[model samples]
Each structure stands twice: as C-alpha cells, then as structure tokens.
Target: MNVLITGATGLLGREVFRAFQKNEWNLTGTSFRRKSPGLVRVDLSQPDTIHDFLNAHLPAVIVHTAAERHPDVSLRDPAGTRRLNVEATAAIASWAATHGAFVLYLSTDYVFDGTKPPYRPSDKPNPLNDYGRSKLDGEQELLSRAQKSSVILRVPILYGPCETLAESAVTVLADQMNRLTEPTLAIEDWATRYPTYTPDVAYTILQLVEYHLAHPDFHGIVHWSGNEGMTKYGMARVLAGQMGFPVERLVPNPAPPSGATRPKDAHLDCSALEELGIGRRTPFAEAIQAILHPA
Candidate 1:
C-alpha cells in the first residue's frame, strides 16, 4: 500500500511511519522543518504546495497528523491555530477528495465538552477551548469535503518515551526522583484524559486504513484511545510507582486558569475500534516501563 503521512516528525506521525515502513508499505512522509530521506517537505499552511505534492505522489492513503496541537499556544494565538488546524486540514481533505485518496485525520478527545465520561463517537461536540474548537472545525470540514472515503480517529493523550508531552513529564519527574526530591504540582482535582501509547495508536491507524481499503463503505468518526481513565495526579502516582519512584513525590493540585479552558473529563471510549479488532487498551504500567526502557 502506498501511503503519505503528514507531521512525520511528530510523536504519533513518526510511529505511524515506522509501523508502515516495518510492514514494507510504500511510505512517504512530510514534515515542515525536519528532513529525512524519502520525506517530502510539505507545509500544510501552504495549500497549493500540498496539493501539488499530493498530485505528484498520488498516495492511496493520507494520514494527517499535523496541527497546532498545543492547547496553551492555541489559546494565545487562535488565528495561527486556525490557519494550521482548520484551513490546512480542509485543504488536504479537499485535495484527497479530488485525487480519490482516502484521508485519515487524527482528531482529539478535546472536541467534547468534558462533562461526560467516556465520550462516544455519536456524542455532540462542544469544544471548551480554541484548540478544541479549531480541531472540530477541521474535522467538520474533512467530513463535509472528503465524504465517505475519509476516516476521523479521535484519540486522547498519548504516552510514550519519544512523545513530547508525556516525555516532558517523565523527564521532569525522573530528574526529581534521581535527586530524591519531590516532584511538585499535579492536577488532582482536574479530572482529565487517559493516554494511548504511540505504538498502539499507530497500529490502530494502519488497521483502519487496511479496513477502509477492503471496505470502502467504512467511513466516519472512530474513537481510538486507551482503556483506562485517571486524573493527572493519579496518572503521575501510577507512573512514579511503576518507575519505582517514591509516590510521596506526587502531590495533588488544581489546574490553573491559563486562558485555555480544558474539559474536566474527556476520556474516549474505543469500542468502535475494538469491534473492528484493531487495538486493545494497554496497561499503564507496561506503557510506563516501555517509556523508561524502549526496545
């Protein structure tokens, strides 16, 4: 299978690229700054360039992972967020529709309001912040333009050693643990998100692509996430315990208002993906161990 992946340097995109490469699929990747052999440099913000690239490659599937993903950054710069997240996504979906390519957009659990636990695919989206709002706009545009050939996979926080978000947390906590000092300030009150390992998410995406190829009728939003849910503080404690760090270092705190209004709970249910026999929930301990010692 010929595949094109955007944001190839990102945590999830890199994993997807690796998965496809291992499967001996004809894979080409795109990145804005980072360059690698066989990787095409296509900035999504430039639709014309992306369109031309797509015309040249003519990939059977396009897995789009590029976006302004930082919630804090999005809150600070809504326009920039929209440019990359919404407009670029729409442009790509439009191009895919014209080229008869299946587009798979990587969405987020942030699309929901966070009022409910374990959000379903059919649930109405009530984004609480600009980041979520931008992503939702992209999702709606992709659905409207790409029609039945496109798939939208909404995932929650992804954890892995190479993952920026989780790794940052891990590194900070690891440093403190090494020094026998308490790592401070975890959000115990702000109940939010479960994490999917990068490999698991990548595997699911590959399966979804294959499924779609065999069953062209398969199209729509699918919730892909880890099986478990926990607060940020709870997750921290689990991580510490798994890594043999003192659990006393983990402290309960609240999420400060930083312009971005996050949903209290945005865990996604992956029954749709499970029904397809694509992916299962990975244990948190196993995920943490993988991060500490990747092999």
Candidate 2:
C-alpha cells in the first residue's frame, strides 16, 4: 500500500514514519523546512501542489499530521493557521473524496473548552484559542468531504524523541529549566495536560490503519491520549529529578498560563479507540528518564 505522511520531519510525523518503516508498505513522508534525504518536500500551503502530488502519488492512505500546532503561534497568525490547517485540509479532503483515498487527520484535545474532563468524540467543541479553532475546522473539512474513508484522531499534548528540547511543549520545559535566568522559574500548575508519548501514538495509528484495511466501514472520529495527567510544574519536578536540575528553584504557579487562553483541562477520552483494542500509554517518569538519559 502507498501511504503518504505529511509533516514527516516533525516530532510525531518522524515517529509515524519510523513505525511504518518496520512494515513492507511503500511510505512517502513529506517534509518542508527540515527536509531529509527520504522525505519529499511538499508545501501543503499550495493547493495546486497538493493536487499535483496526490495525482502523482495516488496514495492508498494519507496520514495528515501537518498543522500550526502551537497556540501562541496560531494566535499571532490566525490567517496563516487557517490557510494551512483548514484550507489546505479542505483541498486534500476534496481530492481524496473523489480519488477514493483514505485520510487519517490528526486533531487536538484543545477543541474543547477544558471545562469537561475526559471528553468523548461526540462532545461539542468550543475552542478557546485560534490553534484549537483551526484544528477543529480542519476536522470538519475532512469529515464533511470524506466521511466514509477519513478518520479524525484527537489527542492531547504530545512528548517524545525530538530534534531539540524546543520541539515539544512538554520537552521545552527542560530547556526552560536548564536556561533559567531568574532565581526561580514559575511553571504553570493550573492547567492539567496529558503528555502523550509519540511512539505510542505512532503504534496506535499503525494498528488503526490495519484495522481499517480489515474493516472498510471503520471511519469517523476517535481519541487516544496518555492516561496520566500532570501540570507543567509537575512535569518540571519530574524532569528536575532525572536531569539533576534544582527542584527547589522551580516554583509552581497555580494560576492559568498567560497568553492564548487555554482550557484548564482538556483530557481526551480514549475509550473510543480503546474499545477497539487500539491504545498505548507509557509511564511518564520512565519515558522522561529514557529521553533525558538516553544511552
């Protein structure tokens, strides 16, 4: 099967590519800024380019992972976010619908207001920021166009092997902790987030793809996330122990994180996918230890 993965150079995309590499399927991972030897450089921002590429590849399945992932970044440029996340997705979905190609769109837990915990796939979304809004719009675009052959997998904040500490919001905490200029660093303790492991999400996607192959009628939205919930402060404390950072210097602020109003807690309910026997969760401490102290 010809499988195309967008944002192949990204943290999650890279892991997804790695997961597929273990299989016999023909995989094409797309890249943009951080182009690699194997990845194809395809600008998802260009509709014509997407059409041309889809025509050439004619992939049996497409794992769409490209998007304006950060909330502050999306807030700074709503137009750009919508163009890439929504408009580009609409174009891909339209093309896939006509061509009979299956699409697996990656979405976020941010779509909810965070007022409710463990949000199901059926829950009505009320995004607090532009990033969430854009992702929700992208999901709507895909579902409307290719409801039968598309899947919207919504997940929480992700953390895994990354090029830099800055690649993930969760890993960036270590960078912040290491380069602290002040006497103490205050981390947000108000908002609770599930720092999902990327490798696990990759595995889940692979299983779902196989499941789809077996059951042609399997489509629509599903959720997968890390089981454990922790605040930035909690994560920072754990990293401090592993990296020998000063836990005393790290302060926990029980106030909402400033910039781009976020949900207090947007824990995604993964039961939808769990019931189908498609889920994985690595212990937070163990995963962080492996990442920080890799042999």
Candidate 3:
C-alpha cells in the first residue's frame, strides 16, 4: 500500500509519520516550510499543484493533515485559510475519487458552536470562526468529492512531542509560564478543551487505516478526543505543579479567549471510533509530563 502524509513535520503529522514507520507500506511524507531527508517538500496552498503531485504517486491512502490550523491566523488571513483548508482539500479529494484512493482528513472540534456539550457525527455544524468554517467547508468538500471510501476524523486540541514548547496550544502555556521577566498571562478558564495526545491519535490512525483496508465501506465522519475536559487555567495549574512553578503566579481569566471567537465547549463525542475499538488516549498530565520532563 502507498500512503502519503501531508504536513508530515507538524505536531500531529510527525507522530503519524513515526507510527507508520514500522509498517510495510510505501510511505511518503510532505513538508512545506521545513525539510528533512525523507520528507518531500510540497505546497498544499497551490491547488493547481496538488492534483499533479498526488497523481504522480497515486497513493492507496492519503492522510491529509496539512492545513492553516491556527484560529487567530485563520481570522487574519481568511483567504489563505480557505485556500489550503477548503480549496486544497477539494483538489485532493477530487483526485482521490478519480484515482480510487481513500482519504483520511484531519478535522477539528471547532466545527461545532460551543453551545452544544457533546457533538455526535450526525450533528449539524455551526462554526464560530474562520478556522472552523474553513474546516467545515473542507469536510463538505471531501464528502462530496471523494466518491471512494474516505474518513473525516475530527479531533480537538492536540499536544505532544513538540520541537518547541510554543508549538502546541497546550504546551504554549509552558512558554507563557516561561515569561519570567514579563507579566503572567491571563489564561482562559472559560472555554473547555480536550487536549488529546498526538502519539495516541497516531496509534488510532494506524488502527483506523488497517481496519479501513479490510473494510473499504467504513466511510464517513468520526470523532476522536480526550475524555477529560479542562480549561486553559486547569491545564496551566497542572503544568505549574509539574514544572515546580508557583500555581499562584498563574492568572486565570474566566472570560472567553480574546481573539478569534471560539465555542465555549466543543467537546466531541468520540463513541463512533471508540465503538470500533480503534482508539487510544493518554491522560493529559501523564503525556504532558513526558514532553515537559523527557528522560
């Protein structure tokens, strides 16, 4: 089997790359800004190039992890976000459909409007920001274009094995805490996020891919998320204790996040994947410990 992973150098994509390394399949990873020995540099933002690029390889499966994922960044450049998130995704799915390749698109929890506590695969999405809207659009693009078996895996707030502490939304708190010379950050205690582990998600992706190979009929949207829900303040306190930083120094802002409007609680109902026995989740504190205090 030939498998292509976009954004192979990203926080989640890197782990997915590692997970597939032990497999027998012919695997190729794509990187944009960053380059490595095994990574093929490709710009996903250029929709015109995506078709020729994928058609050249025609991988049996494609793990489309590339996207302009930052909420504030998306808001700042809505056109750029849509260019990659929706337009580029459309090109990929269209090519996959014609070539009979299965696509596994990595989506986000921001697709839901925070009013809903737990969203199911069947729920109607009402995204609050440009990032969520673009992702939702990408999901629609994939479903409509990919006539072959495809899966849209919607996950939330990923964190694990980052090159820099500021790489992940979860680990960025540690960076904020590191601003010893500056005023403490007012971390959001308002919105609840399920900080899912990337290695665990990578494992789940491998299981899904293997299961999908046997059952090509397994097509549609599925949710995978951490069972534990916590606010930034809650996560910060955990990190503070782990890092030996004063918990009292961490300021908790009970208000909603300042930029890029977010849902209060877009907690995904991960039963679809969980029911298939194709999921693994590491506890937030436990996983964060490994990243913060790597032995």
**Per-candidate local distance difference test:** 0.81, 0.92, 0.92
Error of 1 at 238 (Å): 2.0
- Tell me the deviation in Å of residue 22 in model 3: 1.2
C-alpha TM-score for every candidate: 0.91, 0.98, 0.98
Please give, for residues 1-295, the per-residue lDDT of candidate 3 as tens digits. Answer: 8999999999999999999999999999999999778999999999999989997888999999999999999989999999999999999999999888999999999999989779998899999999999999999999899845789999999999999999999999998898777556678899999999999999999998999998988889899999998999999999999999889888889888788999999999988787789899888889989999999
Question: Which scores better on TM-score, 1 or 2?
Answer: 2
How would you encode candidate 1's per-residue C-alpha lDDT over 180-266 as one tens digit per residue? 533554445465667688888898888898898889999999998876777667777776776776676566777543567888888
List model 2 lDDT by residue over 250-274, tens digit each.
Answer: 9989989888999999999888787
Worst 10 residues of 2 by lDDT: 42-51
Displacement of residue 39 (Cα, Å) in model 3 is: 0.4
